[model samples]
Target chain A: MVNLGSIWQNLLASQAPLQSMTGNATTMAGLATYSLPQLPYAYNALEPYISAQIMELHHSKHHQTYVTNLNNALKVHVAAIASSDIPAQIAQQPAIKFNGGGHINHSLFWKNLAPAETPETNYSKAAPSLAAEIEKTWGSFDEFKKAFSAALLGIQGSGWGWLVKESTAEKGRLRIITTKDQDPVVGGEVPVFGVDMWEHAYYLQYLNGKAAYVENIWKVINWKTAEERFQGSREDAFADLKALL
Target chain B: MERDISDSRNQSANSLTLSLSLDKQAVTMSASLFRATPVARSALRAASAVKPAATFVRGKATLPDLQYDYGALEPYISSKIMELHHSKHHQTYVNGLNSALTTIAEAESKGDFTKAASVAPLLNFHGGGHLNHTLFWENLAPASREGGGSPDGALGKAITTEFGSFESFVKQMNAALAGIQGSGWAWLAKDKAANGKLALITRANQDPVTGNYVPLLGIDAWEHAYYLQYENRKAEYFEAIWNVINWKTVAKRFEA
Candidate 1:
């Protein structure tokens, strides 16, 4: 498992202006900004399931805008804090939450998707433990898929559907949940995988056929990543952020 | 605009007293803050500048009454979809808008800019939703009444000039509606910045048409607007909605 906590700690430490002045090359010059993470595979890697057009726009345009906005919001937030302007600080919160969650969710989303027909796409083969856990919870993999798909369709507006692992006393327990807008899975829950239900995610290819989009998403789901997230700590699951830092 | 505000104030008078005090407190605070600190003046100016008109007065945004029955636009838009869209979806936006405005007012009164700023997106979203739906309800009439057919006079001439022909305008508007990336609206608006020329525009996620464009007609592109009746075949919904479009309302806005 990746020791992402140390990396995160180091990132926080590197944010100090002193660290930049001390010739710490690893620290970003001046304020550290969260940059967009590169996709694990080519843009067309998930083709037929998700079109090249959708992938290109979703990543290069939509996700990139979120990353850019998040960095800008963070910069403004830091300035607001320094000046002790409470309203300015509060004003920045929504943008921070929206763009930050967008970045985090998209980062997790890209990683949890693999090229169709890959070993990672085979749930039982790549994720026996997670498959077993899913079967235990929802009776079978097919049943779990049905339940998750239903949750996805049930969203009224812009949102995401997530498969999460409960933390603490319910560590191994799994749940399917939906979050409105760009809300991330919070409260110590580990997001095993998330399927973005935002129209931009599928609209270019599927048009209005959301059900078909949900059905085909399973074709590209990376069970290897699911199993890894299920078995490891939350830190391990979010180690993708290290690249952005 | 003054008449509309007065009418809305009269309609919401019973519920206005509590919130009116809150608004007065907020206005008073901003005025005092304008004098007290130079640093806060810019923030307050920013806050007021982007603040929606609905937040200024009249307590809360109440759901407007439909002139016709929910089933009035039947055969085109189902009664079921109309009911849910107006009552459930639009009501949610109204409640959210009110709550966000109240939060902002209270926060500003206490000099908690953080709290006021935090609710800004909610203000934009719900306020836009309320205003859009209110306009949308008026933009439709029972087909037997003023709905359907083609616009006449200046609005008709403007549409022809902007989009070639009435048929072409309808085709282009439907295309615009279909091409929307997410939950949003496609609008036929008057561009105040360009000498009231007609324009076609789309807003993502309940963003009100503001700053130069006056939305004359808007077609919601959200799945909920059509999913119950049309399902995934939203092209059908887009086509059918025109049969119920109140060209009179569009013309009124255009002429205004």
Candidate 2:
């Protein structure tokens, strides 16, 4: 049965959305939220490879919109509960979930990207530790990129690219792999490197031209961030497999 | 059971959920490896790792090996069905494939399309047979693991993007297969048109849905595959077979 006292209060309300900006732990009664995150890098920095117009639209319009919808959904979610319309509340979950996640992922995405202005650090040489790992196992970095890119470009449609770690039967060593869509290798493979190939990701700047964007993104790739991801991925992957041994 | 973690590859039960994170605080990067015994491993390794020796069967192909045992497909497929299908039906295709290939090679060497044109049907039948059987084994799982349901991860995402939901994909495949009146197989080919990688496609019959698609997942909708057990119940077989789907293999293929 409906426990009007406890269930209504709890069900009518939702947990706070996880946003780093709200530094304080205090809650705002019904539900607290954060606003759209401004881009750390200027609009025009990416240039011809990625235009300022695209960046402005992508960050300001696309991303900010996700934030707006997320907040709007939460508000409706609260009203639906207060009115006690279970169906209305139930139906709103997916929009809330998708927009909320979209907001979160895009926020992180903005921070990861920067303009291709000055010299950008890329995986000119895969980091030594990761490189040594790949060399010892897969033979050469070129071969690794070929195999990895094969999986990355293979994605059928709009989705995030992933670099997953997996163990081959012969080699107990960890190696990176690629996967399509929302699948993250179920948390085993931390995303050390990625490129969002979805049309919305680069359509404005690169248009239907995927090849150009992929080629250009390499120049602006933040390899150091990818390296950190690789480090974190290795720490968990090897030891986790050892348990089976 | 508590102290000793089991070998994941041989995991017979379906509760196995492949995750990248375990309590050990490790990054996950694994798919289920099914090779348990050295013998199974050796044969599989030979089959999988045999550097594309893929004997191009020119005409009607045949069943290769059960790997486990001829009786292995028992219960689901039955030894009676396998014996006849393998020894009789499949053997016929193998013999035919060899003949067509030899004939084609001779014609090509002699620069004669006239002879090869006549042999086109033979190549389609036999080549299609070989391709189908080669892919069949790769698609199936043992009885314990049968009943492979919808895919997850990147595989699931692709299927969803390409053809709505997983159930919808199955409906399309089933409809496409059912539309094949006489004899043929159903396939979910690895599509590469988008990113020059894997794409899912279905071929009608002895026609290998040619071009490029890594034959990652397949099903023998031909009556010969299940008429013995279900007898005109192809739909039932399709439903039952989903349980034994070697998702781990499919996942690995996608990852590869």
Candidate 3:
């Protein structure tokens, strides 16, 4: 079974970057998700963090494909579910749920995976404010990884690796969380971060080595973006935390 | 296997139980140092049946009003971050979901499966978006009115009983959340199925837990939630969010 220290050490591991997001169709205002979050570095920037070839396909083909499929999937959802026929309506769920979550989560996941070491970039060097927050919680960044990576490596199949907020009796401090399939965090569970470990997500990048992929996820992490998430949810996160013992 | 989209039309009731994360906080419950549990250990499941009437919020999911101001979560969350998450990303989900719904409505009205099949994915994408954002607002609170804090009384006692201590539970849960392989969710649910009536569970996709458990609290482990703050070190982000949990809400939820 997983122990506290081992988990703690892994949690203390390095940080992550941003995920890429693209979209289709337009809005009433007519935007195609124009500002889809981009990678902090070049496709090859992740190199050892994530192979270049894998990065290429992941960003261009895989993620982009999700966007395409997501658009296509919704088109299908329309025709099937509208039927008064029970059978036809029920059949459309897998596509709607799976592809839908894939599209949304992947877009965010891409924004989360940034390529570090981009010299001369203004947002490099994991935001100090965020690091301070990390330091306050886990004692040290290393300790956080020990806990985070241990969790990241324990996946079974096509699913995501997540870092979510926890609830306490006091609601004082939030804890990390992981969800299966497209399961969601409820009760004001602020989503600070997540990683996709589905084979399709990384089989191409690191082959069957999910561990390697999970570990390297830090090298190109986008702390600045995370800082924004933390700062965004801070009031609620701690407001709840302060309520707890 | 064909699944039921009937559930899709129904919106989960706004029964967000705020208070202690309770059973889930079994220690190392320290902030900024959360961990993930492997998805292999738990299957995605749903809360015990407390079925409510079907809710059909047609059109698009709208931007919800925050319980507090955008910057109310300062220190834990930044104003800039809040602005973007709610107004930008979350809104996108609402718009995208509505667009999908409209398309589906037209296709089905025309009795065209081929056309319906074409836009099916958007339903998931936008629907998931609508669902996630709605839940996000329900579980949070303003720091002043018993939102962020620690557990006490019954909530505290329960956490102590299950995970030994709050610290242990937190570590384990953090491990569980960090352990997720992809974008999904981690939760602290009360499993009424068993005698104890509570257990911590995690689900991978946008699939809601469909078993005998009820959600007390959930964390969005998707990167967008924290990539702006913690980067790849998800554990740190997990740990840091603790300072802003809005526990008063959690406690009241548990009592309900």
Candidate number that wins on DockQ, 2 or 3: 3
Ranking by TM-score: 1, 3, 2
Candidate 1 structure quality by residue, lDDT tens digits, A1-245: 21333223223332343331233322322456778889999999999999887788789877887789877876776666456565675676666667777888899999999999999998999999999899999999989999999999867568999999988746489999998777766557889999999877886666556799999999999999999999998878787786576
lDDT of 3 by residue, A203-237 (tens): 44454345777777777666655655555553442
Give candidate 3's iRMS in Å, 1 decimal.
10.7
Mind sharing the TM-score for model 3? 0.43
Order of all candidates by DockQ, from best down to worst? 1, 3, 2
Clashes per candidate (backbone, < 3 Å): 4, 32, 216
Among all windows of 10 consecutive residues in model 2 chain B, the one with the lowest summed lDDT is: B1-10
Question: How accurate locally is residue A38 in candidate 2, as Cα lDDT from 0 to 100?
Answer: 66
Error of 3 at B102 (Å): 1.9
Question: Model 1 over residues B1-256: C-alpha lDDT tens digits?
Answer: 2233333333323322323223332444222211222233445566654443333432445677788899999989989778878887788887887787667665754568798878767777776787778778888998989889999999999999999999999999999997664478999988877999999999888877777677789999887787667755679999999889999878877876
lDDT of 2 by residue, B130-245 (tens): 54565566666666554366679998887788888888887777776654433566777665455734454555545555544555677776656665566444677776676667
- Taking all chains together, each candidate's TM-score versus the true structure is 0.53, 0.38, 0.43
